[model samples]
Target: MTTVPRRFEILLVAGFTESDETPPTSAHALRSAVVEATGETGESGYPRYAGNGMEADIDPATRTVEALLVDGAEIDYGLSVRVVAAPAT
Candidate 1:
């Protein structure tokens, strides 16, 4: 089994809330939300944020976001994120 992390593109969906309908506008915000929802941390004990989009490291064997067992929902912003696709190996 490989221990290296693979790159995967993530999808972020805006969920409906009683008071909020605005979706996340920046990658930073999405990254923060993902970290809050998944509670995932890197070797330095901090959430890793990729470039400008919603991209993250996913275990290729599992092909799932770590700590995000459910449909990846963040209650604060009512944002839902998921692993959409991985780059061609």
Candidate 2:
């Protein structure tokens, strides 16, 4: 039998409110999620979206990054990224 410690998965989501702009992506688009280390509260770089006064946020509990634009606004496009942990050998 093999023992494995419990880990978390991170995901990112974006919502557009009738806006014609490309969604923002992680600075490290290559690698999205990271394993939570011992007391590791690392912060990732969130680049500006054409300086449109927009910013990205993350929810550690839900492990999700959501845009704060949910006020009866029409979300045209959306993106959901699933981050999976590597299998143990």
Candidate 3:
């Protein structure tokens, strides 16, 4: 049997709590997750600092991602995310 290639779209976020306060919408947050998932983090530097943190841990099977969000203080908040594949064009 021939193999069929599947295309998937994924999104990850720190969490809905912090995101709701941000100017962007949930959809935007989701898209950001996809961007983060695809980005690469090199050695600690200007380039790596500029990238999103959520992309660091993206799960292909569950299509999930995890990240930490920092509030005004040094304390970090965690976000567990799940991504649903987008429909084919």
Candidate 4:
């Protein structure tokens, strides 16, 4: 990989936590290409820091993205928000 700083691919992760307490087991993993591209178009490019968390329960089998999780809480379809890379630190 190139050692270019601030130049890396972000990832979008989600989880299903209705019963478990320790951590989530089932999850959705997706490349953050869409978020990166949109950020570029919006003039706010990659390496963004959302401060809070952004995630969604994306089901490939059902072709659905729902149950957004932000700041450790379940919310509605919140994909129309800024999605950044990493743990925001």
Give the top-scoring candidate (lDDT).
Answer: 1
Candidate 2, superposed: residue stretches over 4 Å from native? 1-6, 10-34, 44-58, 65-80, 83-89
> Which residue pairs show backbone clashes in model 2?
none
Candidates, ranked, lDDT: 1, 3, 2, 4
lDDT of 1 by residue, 33-62 (tens): 222223355444434435332334444455
Off by over 4 Å in 4: 1-52, 76-89
Cα deviation in Å at residue 32, candidate 3? 3.9
Quantify how close model 2 is to the true structure by its C-alpha RMSD in Å.
12.4
- TM-score versus the correct structure, for each prediction: 0.35, 0.22, 0.30, 0.23
Misplaced by over 4 Å in model 1 are: 3-5, 15-49, 53-76
Tens digits of per-residue lDDT, candidate 3, 1-89, equal 64212333344445555455543334765434223333443332111111333323334444433432222122234643444554445
Candidate 4 has a TM-score of 0.23
Q: Which window of ten consecutive residues has the lowest lDDT sum in model 4?
A: 35-44
Better of 2 and 4 by lDDT: 2
The whole-model lDDT of each prediction reads 0.42, 0.34, 0.36, 0.32
